[model samples]
Target chain A: MTEHPGRITREDVAHVARLARLRLTDDELDLYTGQLGVILDHAADVASLDLDGVAPTAHAMAVTNVLRSDTPRPGLDRDEVLAAAPEVEQHRFRVPRILGEAP
Target chain B: MDRYQGGGVVTEGWELVIGLEVHCELRTETKLFCGCRNLFGDEPNSNVCPVCLGLPGSLPVLNQRAVELAMAIGTALHCDIRPSTFHRKNYFYPDQAKDYQISQYDEPINVDGWLDLPDGFRVRVERAHLEEDTGKTTHAGASGRIHGADYSLVDYNRSGVPLVEIVSAPDMRTAVQARAYATELRAILIASGASDGKMEEGSMRVDANVSVRRSTDATFGTRCEIKNLNSVRSLGRAIDYEAQRQVALLESGGVVEQQTRHWDEGTGRTETLRSKEEAYDYRYFREPDLVPVVPDAEWKAAVADTLGLMPAQRRARLVELLSGGNGAGGNDGDGDGDGELRVDQIATVVDLGLDDLVVGAVAAGVPATLALARTANEAATDAEAARRLDGSSYVALLTLEASGSLSATQAKVVLGDLLLAGGGDPAMLAKEKGFEAMSADSLVETVGQAVAAEPDAWARYCDGEDKLAQVFVGKVMKATRGQANGKAVVAELQRLRG
Candidate 1:
């Protein structure tokens, strides 16, 4: 299979926008796609700069076990918790129809 | 969807492959990268700043405390403390003010770790990484149900909250084990002082990935992920439901699709949220605004110091401390019958946030059993002690019982009074309120009065009618507000009647 060009196109950007749930305008999508390509390309450059034996870094801080004593605390009352939700009923948050119809 | 007829339909055996991604909100006074408060509920948008809101030209400053907490959790989980990196997970959901979430991706802080289960079983932990929380969204006017009427409200109080997401390997085979694993994991987190494990308040959220395969199959089946499961019970139930759904589909000669699903805890089912996507979906890359986080050795040591006693070690210590004559302390030789507090009982006390109080009261000279009772009595009898007599007051009550100043039953009575009235001393209040036991002279006088007043009853007792013994016993006890010892009262009354 022929590898696609290194540059990320508008189509690639549109596909991502759809997945991420962003309703960007065509021009904005175009702009971000190019910008994202450049950013990824720069990251690719960093990925290339390697000392053969260098270790991969995940966390910047060298920290160890941080913990709390195992103790149960009084939780927020149901009403107090429910009061914060914009839509709530019977002590739970309510939302809208999230599922699309199945084929 | 194919409907299976009948309420209790029996199905063939299918093994479930369950994995959990637990996202716990880290306990910190401020946001992960900003000074804004990390509180859950405040006035909407009140805790926002240019830094958290991702305004132009505002650089992200990593919180030292957040990193320490992350590493603390990593160590507690037995994860390899590998060098890690943070990347911007690009996504645009309504809750996030910043389109991209600053999170650890390919290079996670913690590598492979294992959590021990009750029966020597283990849950494999894949990675534990740090990330900033997104703002909250509330659908207004609507039932908050996805399918309904009206607009939604947004709250940013939870935004920028420091969080660590622990992803586990699909090693769990049963829902019960999954629940236990989550509970144990939460217990460890709480013990480490990392998080409160308040699932209901959204501090601890779980996403379960579940699939079903033939019991003997070595290869895995397609999996469906259920998100936003807040409670342990819900996590187990959702996993079971999702796994069963997949099994049913496979049994019906259908395929199990890989998708993101939402759990409807109300109906006890899962629904598809999104389909699987390739790498280009997220388009993750290095965060330009923030520099690499290189936690030095000293910082790692400081973080290690932050870790408290882990749950397993704490449990063993508690068991040893409560164990009698086992060289673990406590006066087990007294034969007072309380050798060590049961694990369940200790767990209960911990649940009530009364661990310190129990220990304090015990140290202050209360017997184990009497502490609760004494606290009750002290609370009922003394106002000041009553104010202090919560679940922990039992410790002091135990002391009183151990000292022989109060009986177990009396301690309970005092505890009840204190729990309700909020102030009173067991001894002084009992005396002032005439709750004290009647003196011998007073009991004798009342018995004599009863004999004189009731000639028939007295004659029956004089005739040695055995039943009259009960009558005399009742009369004396009535005179003493039920505090008189029944046996003593019967004898005194019998002599007076004769």
Candidate 2:
């Protein structure tokens, strides 16, 4: 959908903000669009590299299979965890009328 | 909807294309990233940690057993193992504490596999990727459904539980094929120890992507995803209903919209849950917390070794055993003591993990038909205990029934006791239940009375109406209090006729 690489349009900023549930003013949108544009442009500069042998990376660390055994350990107490929630009912965290899957 | 065809047939010339996404929970002791117990029906919110709750400063660590189970599942379906990474499927929902589900996108661990149904149909598996499950949310207030629910309570006990969502290519054509694919995949999941495969318990779930086209050669039409199909029966019913709905929409000169719909099992129809127009753009990005999962060759082989005989292999083994190691494999059987085991009987036995009992009983000189029948019918009634039913106990019950020492009904009663007790001496249970075999003379007297009372039927039986023999046997069984052996009754009836 990007016609120019790393070019963040105001519409793109607005769309992404809506997806992230961020209510942004027009001035803020213009500001973030420029900020995000510069950030993406800096990152997209990697595309200029000509060497093709580099493997894609998910993390900065070179670790693989950072696994733990399937063992059970006691976690946070239910009372303690529920105490931090905004609402509680019948031993569960109650939220206001949140419907089914995200649309 | 008024013109909907019966049995989910879209029109006479239309073709049904279906793809299934099955989410199965891995049978591990802890959550996918944390050490909290991965259990079902525990106290609400009991299993919670900083990592699973998406608290800041907490890092995620992969669970070794989850990866192994996923690999075993992929191997069972003939998948290619590869290095994979996780991404965040960003969305907002009460079920997920993170507000964004960590899932595998673009790259997954297992790919390009195929699952073969017992009837020789193969559904290509596109990918099987690991992810974390979400919390349980129960809607509050009127209707209990989301339509009018005032609030919803969330339990994070299920949060971060390990799940592998298997996406299949849209290869299925008929509703029957979709059901069969689910069934066969469930069996494989259980056999490979990847999951418990209990759909009713939510260990395994299915969502069908159904579309209708004019013909098999035509391009696929827009599909509406049907969600929350909990059982194989409901999976078939939902697919049929969704197909009919799409076809009806198209025939009425209306366009089918690509959307997600919930299959209401109560209403027996698929209702729109959400449409694709407002679909969330799940901002997928790599998780910098956990590193890549690159399964080495040795570890992959070790996982493969744990995958024992799948359902198809077990069914074939039982079929070969029932044929005394010589009969060809086919389902062409009547199952009336003709020394041939029906294909469906073998499938049921194997599916319930009762093939070992059948194999054991048949090896003890019990006729294959008798062993297969009892195991497939009576033992199948209590599959949980039947799986643990000892070989000797099953053989003992079958021997008594086959040798005319106990009637079929007596064997059934004693077998029920054996199953309930988990294991017991069959003869002792029979004696304790006072199920004594009748004397031949007593049996003759009983058969004589049954024949005399059913003279009209007996007349036809004598004139070679073989089907009437079952009528007299039923009558004799009732008179003798179910202690009359069917074979002996038949022999005595023949003698009286001569």
Candidate 3:
């Protein structure tokens, strides 16, 4: 459990928006800063609960080991799959200069 | 205590600390969370579905065989299998079509395992966790570098493939030890049937974290992670180069920066990729679409049963066979006279995953030394052909050599023919190639003729200049048209001398 340090600043919102490739206006950044602050406050309230012995739950349902066999099934047709992309070249998904590089 | 000096700049007191992270793709038929075929070299975007492509309203289901193979690796590395869950590692990368990768962060499937290298050193495995592979991005530019690339192409055929990343502790002291660890781990992966261990094809990838510190320092220096180390040789070279770079920097009163470096194989140097401040935070959170995986006792035991003998165990078994005692008899007479197999020969057999071939031949009553030499030297040349070879043929070849029906050289030629062209019996091949072993009496007569003809060489041999014995053996081989066994000729010469 963790606590919210303080109000979410406009700079923080701007930084996140840039990382997400979101072209947010100054007004939008200010609005997001306020809205995100409220969400963080609410999250901190939940985190403030004194449930020391309780286990953290990852899913709401009581399911575990939901897996499929390794056998292959019919996949989407290649033409149909590529048709949905914005661009295609040599049967591949073509994109503009991929920002930095791949890891 | 090997000190690395980078760029010919001597930093004699600095010790290099290296740790490796290896990612091996599991040998599953389908994708990790979809039914798309998990294959390589297929047409781009040919093996994709809505789930793998991250289309709207598509959900992911775990692949059971991938988990089982991950557990098999854990068991082989002596890891503790635990209940694990997946998380969404959020980032902005076109390679990951979803802009987020489904991976295991905190609670991985396998934890706290250790692998023992053939050099008698052990490396602690931090975790062996499962994740989905991203797409392949091919940059197009004059330099072919991403920084100056005009555009890029993406192949989703590799996407959604299952991968298990084995992270090792910073327990390696030198580059040689690091390579040995990777080699042994690759053998274990191949032995466990978890991965094909093809680093060149990108099925198995390695990234090395290297740092240099003063020999007397109690704390570690700053480390840089070097990527693009696709081969074992590249991994070693990158670590050595990076360590020297860091050492040279420190010697000039400069601090080592925490960054990710790219290994330029052509230039044999590491260049800065990005600094820590520019690195992605990879905001991780629990993946809501998937459930936890908890393998019960029975499931673990079943996976354990499927695991074959690991490389170390196989090497030990081969050594036992080479020592000739058979674990019960008083000297079965199969040793190489020194009761030890050469380390390189053992590594060759084990690394090629052909130890079982040698073992099977020995089990069929062929001498261990003969089996080891043939497999290590001859069969190992063509690994693909060797894997398809029948154990009976291998044993037949060795048996022929052991019984003196074919000399060692002749046996190698016949074995090479069998491996390359794949037909004809060993004896038949020997006859067709004019490599038939001469009779003992014929060899005796040839040796007698050689002694009479090469009087000066035979007199030198009889005068305790034993080095001249090769002269008589060579002459006998010439007289017999290379059909006489050299060992037999030598034995006949010794008998005549007596």
Candidate 4:
């Protein structure tokens, strides 16, 4: 996810920061632009290598259909799970008023 | 399935184009990634496990039953099964157990299929992807909207439940076509045994992408995604309102903006919920915990075997039976000779899954048309009892009617009694109801008296005013206390006119 599509620009970093809800100073934005740019360049160098006959890999281990049979079992206690939340109301987790806006 | 050229749900010069995304929950014993019970109406937060709660140190394990159900749904939709990978859809919501929901992104499980409506309109299905459900949140405020809600209560009982999101291409050209597509899709999901397809309980939900364009224009207009359609009726109404809204905007020289709209059932309008920009940016990335799922040939075959006859096929089977062709060709379905054989009635009978009763009766020498009418009208009224009603009893009742032993009025009453009391001899029920066939001489006298009572109408009938048959038949029926056969009365009237 840290890898860029091509080259990472400062504006791209700012947009990513906005989506991540990170309030970064201008200096930090500039710093991450350089940092992510190098990572993208390394990724590009690896991508530029010629290995035409090799199949693409999505995972390192290269396995498929790792599954488990469906069966019901006990879960965490309700009170215990609700206690872990920041707020609880009426036997449920309670959260502050949130806007309809999205990331 | 009536094909819309233009101006079906839009203006005369406009045409509607709609694509639907249907999200249906998978019927499974456990959560998609955990063993916690996937049961609804349970104690709140009782189903929460480490994996579902997104707690650290817990990795997800795909449920085999869930994958099987997804494949079954895909096969029922006639989609090509393929390997799929899960990705994290990043978003922020209080009810989301995970800030990034596990969903299939670019690679989905099913693709490149089409659903045939009973009317034979083929709607191409783009893809059906596997995803997990979110928790339920109820806002506590006057408007019950998140904008002004004081707080929200979250129920994790539904979190991590498996779901299949079936997306359709923009092929529908009217509100009715969109509705037919949704209804057919629901039937397919239920027939595949993948989901219950209950919209009231939120097992199945639909989001419509609707736009209208000039009939002469090749380019599509800006579309809005209408969300929160809980039922099929709401789906049609919302699409109709949204299409009109867009058409109005264009006519007024107001450019339509791309946005997600909310359907307010109470207000009967669609309003902007949020900009499309905020909704589409789901920074998706591959889930490292889960591997890709690829169904082999044998597994795909097994999934395909689970699909039974869907609604469309069932409807065609009934049509074939009605037309006296053993699944050969379509029927006139004009509903003229024997029964009110309208298309919608057939659909209703099939929807209730009662076509078997009609089929059995037809096989037993009862007229198919009469059997269909009784099945669609009387039996459908008490569907549960009718499903349990014996085929022999049904055939006996219809046989009595078809053989002219019992008048249509008496037959209807007998059928109602059979349905209410579970089962009985139809002939005996009619006799108990004092239904005795009027003698031919009495019917002739009754028709003569009826003609004398309305001489002017009789003269007009003799002059070929064909609508007066019901007037004389009514009189004869009343005089004989609904015991006289209508056809006999009509025959007597025709004799007197000649």
Candidate 5:
């Protein structure tokens, strides 16, 4: 029903989930594979639609030249920001090892 | 969760390709697509509204300021400001409650620009577009790991903030150049007044795409995307480390795999985060709720006008002005008063830190030269001192420097004391602090005293131990408590010793 149909498969869905850091179960991955295929296929259909004369819209706001004076306002209150974090030490946001070891 | 899941990683004679997606939060008071506050590091969930929070029944109204800032950046980067439209980039994440992000698809705000490097290489700007920011998420407990974490906390303060995403073409050859390009880009963005461009505050973020290939290969090798590279040094170092890793793998007859990588600042290395995916991953499409974005002719022209005289051009102009004796006279052509006034003007301009502001002040009936000199004199002191010196006191500083009663250096000391003494006059500070320049005659007398004090040094000087002359000069300078002109003292000593 659309161009580029079936380009995305179950493997592609799994790859995407990994990229997005989403831990999806096998059943969810299979469902997303089908759902993503349909969505991309629909996008391909839209990409193929006859709108040669239609102008592409990038922004909805018809405004321009919005500028603030070159004045530096007060920035973040350091102590106040650290208050929201569940755990903070020495003014730094503590996080576990996200990157693995070498070798 | 398994750390590695891909079938095969690319390893030997393979090159890696990279691209960058840099997003800078636009410096504006209001949100990108709404009237809610556009701020960073605010009280948790303080600057949020229904539109930003993705509440049902809330309609979107685009902030005019965000669009203008986007256009300003587009034009500055020399992008073709295509009459384009917006689309919804759909993705479901906990931080983004909207389930879809309203961003430009094929029709970005600007397209096809190049950033010229000093080394004759150019990094092409693929496109720059405007979008709203999502809230931040923090995984807490269990060593604060994203996986196996007890719970994840979300902060909505930054939600719906305006951002300009500047995507660069794969033109960077080395890690150093990529980092340089990023730095220059930040300077331009900051100068343009489009964004605060503060990396520490997370106002500006860089997503680096790095890959390496052989010198002879025409095709690019499998590339890895390195995300979360914070500072300029880290970006370049991460790229270098990743490239070396890839090259080592290739040299060892291994294959390179296409994947997204995460950079660890602590370790100064990159690790596999996830394999790269095709565009279908996000399932991007046009948002049915929002219509296409369109800017009128008048709007475009106004934005163009606002991007007037960037900081680069202003720096050049200031350099020319200083060199041409328009200010800060290096030498007067006719030996006429070397325009101490002009020197003041240059000093003022330098003190203001913003050329445009200085120019504006000059045009506003302020004696440009006097105001500038006064500004310069005040700047050389502490903030308190600068505040203490009333308008009239600055004039006294210029007069002293011009009349040769005090050198520029001494005037600064006097200004500092005046500022620190609070309620003290600069002239009185100079008199009480003995901040006066030594004249030729007084310097000679001090030099004679030093020569007499160090008879052995005088004998060393007469014996052609030329280096001892410096010792004599030092003694003379010390005797005068560094107030004497060491040059004049040296000349006087040479004559007496001979």
Candidate 6:
């Protein structure tokens, strides 16, 4: 994982924001680009470490296989779960027209 | 020079390269990360919880059974089970309330496996990774499609359900081969007891990547992914239609664009849904909530021990049984060379999941051919009942048929009754149904009376009009109210004629 300085461009930020459905303004994109640059710089610094034998860590700790039994427990009431949504219809969470097909 | 005929044209000088991605819902009792019931067709939103709903301050805990099932699936597919981690696939969709999905990235639990189809073509499995399912979205309005819908309703009951996405290498050369791979994979999934492999209920979903290439070329063409294929038939049809569409496009001086297409079952064509440039970049990153999955050797062995006979192995066993041989000594090296009837009988037995019943009958000394026919024909009619049937009772009925104590028709009728009514004494049931076998002495007496009465028909039978034996059998059946065995009557008539 080599460092590529100045790669977090404003255009990249804008494209990612758009994909995330975030309507970011020009100022916001520029601000995020610089912020993202700092984060990438930190990642680059970590990548430049000379620890060849160090294994990549997906989690902060060495914990693995933490799981619960598959037995079912009571879930929230239908009305209670629907109460948190903006709108409810036919015991379901209703939203505006979906713009695109499902992935 | 192998060509396929579809869309009113011979697709000559071209080959289809297809790969399939199948998502199967694990049969866990609860959701993947929450204690909510992982049931289908429940009341909408009833199975949701704060964890699955992605409420603030709620964290997800992996289900132990889900992991074991995943391991079982990996073992069944001959994949290497390794420590795997989950990542967040970032996307914006109404169905995913969390605005992202927790899925495995880079390192999955299973990798580098291959599935050998019944026809003996091996499809390399790239990976089978674990993930969570999204909610259901129902589009309202006239078209009932997302393009022109008033609004969509989301049900979170299915959200956060455990799913394993099995990805295959682009090794299939024909739509038929693709279908065979899916079918065999589904059987493996079922055999592993990890998933129910129900495609119609959305438990199993298949997506295909299809591309066409010149027969002499080695490089692959631009592939288009077909989505929302619900059935194996639809999968095969969509691949064929899409492959032919690409060939026709290239032949007519046009280039096939790499895109995602929707299989329209009504129109029987693949319609463009989205193109490659517009495809969503998932922006995957490691999930900060859950930990990695590392199954130790002991646990892996325990899961491996649960593996049962897969469909292919079961099919081979049934074929051996049908050829009148035991498991060890069955050296019919050419079971595949047998005629199509034997092939179909073996398939019917295995596909119906009744191989164990037939095996049990054979173990009980019943003839293999009779057991295969009974299981495939009579028991297969009601699979649910047949599954619960007592194997010994089935063996007893077949034994009666084999020992000449009951006619074939009487045995079949008895078997059907036993299947519907659950376990009971087969002989007692036969007696209750008035199917008592006719005595040998009485059969001779009846044949004598029939010969004295029907001289003409008897003389015709003696003169080698073998068809006239039916007349005497019919008379015996009429006198005995269908209790006398027709075959016994025919035998007795032959004895008298001699």
Best candidate, TM-score-wise? Answer: 2
Candidate 1 per-residue lDDT over residues B26-57, each given as its tens digit: 98888877777788767566666667666567
- Candidate by candidate, in order, the iRMS in Å equals 9.9, 1.5, 1.2, 1.9, 9.0, 1.1
lDDT per residue (tens digit) for residues A4-91 in model 5: 3457877777876775668999989777777777888778898988989886543365443333333223434546655645655544
* Model 5 segments more than 4 A misplaced: A1-103, B1-18, B118-120, B145-148, B277-280, B326-498
By DockQ thresholds, what CAPRI class is model 4?
medium
Task: Sort the predicted structures by DockQ, highest score first.
Answer: 6, 3, 2, 4, 1, 5
Chain B vs. true chain B: TM-score for each candidate?
Answer: 0.73, 0.81, 0.80, 0.73, 0.68, 0.79
Q: How displaced is residue B469 in candidate 4, in Å? A: 34
Could you give the candidate ranking by lDDT, starting with the highest? 2, 3, 6, 4, 1, 5
List-wise, what DockQ does each model earn? 0.10, 0.63, 0.64, 0.52, 0.09, 0.73
TM-score (chain B) of candidate 2:
0.81
TM-score of 6: 0.82
State in Å the error of residue B148, model 5. Answer: 5.1
Off by over 4 Å in 1: A1-103, B1-13, B277-280, B325-341, B347-365, B369-394, B401-498
Model 2: per-residue Cα lDDT over B39-79, one tens digit each:
99998998899988888888889999999999999899899
Task: Identify the leading candidate in terms of lDDT.
Answer: 2
Instruction: Give a tens-digit lDDT track for model 4, residues B84-164.
Output: 899999888876767879999989999999999878899999999999999889888897886788989898889899999
Question: Model 2 residue B194 lDDT?
Answer: 88
Q: How many backbone clashes are present in model 1?
A: 56
Per-residue alpha-carbon lDDT of model 2 for A1-103, expressed as tens digits?
2234348788988998998989999989878887888778778798887759987777898888999999998899888898999999999999999655643
The segments of candidate 2 whose C-alpha lies over 4 angstroms from its true place after superposition are A1-6, A100-103, B1-8, B325-335, B338-341, B388-396, B399-406, B424-498
Residue-level lDDT tens digits of model 3 in B390-476: 777777777667656576777888888888766446766787888775544456667888899988888888889988999998887
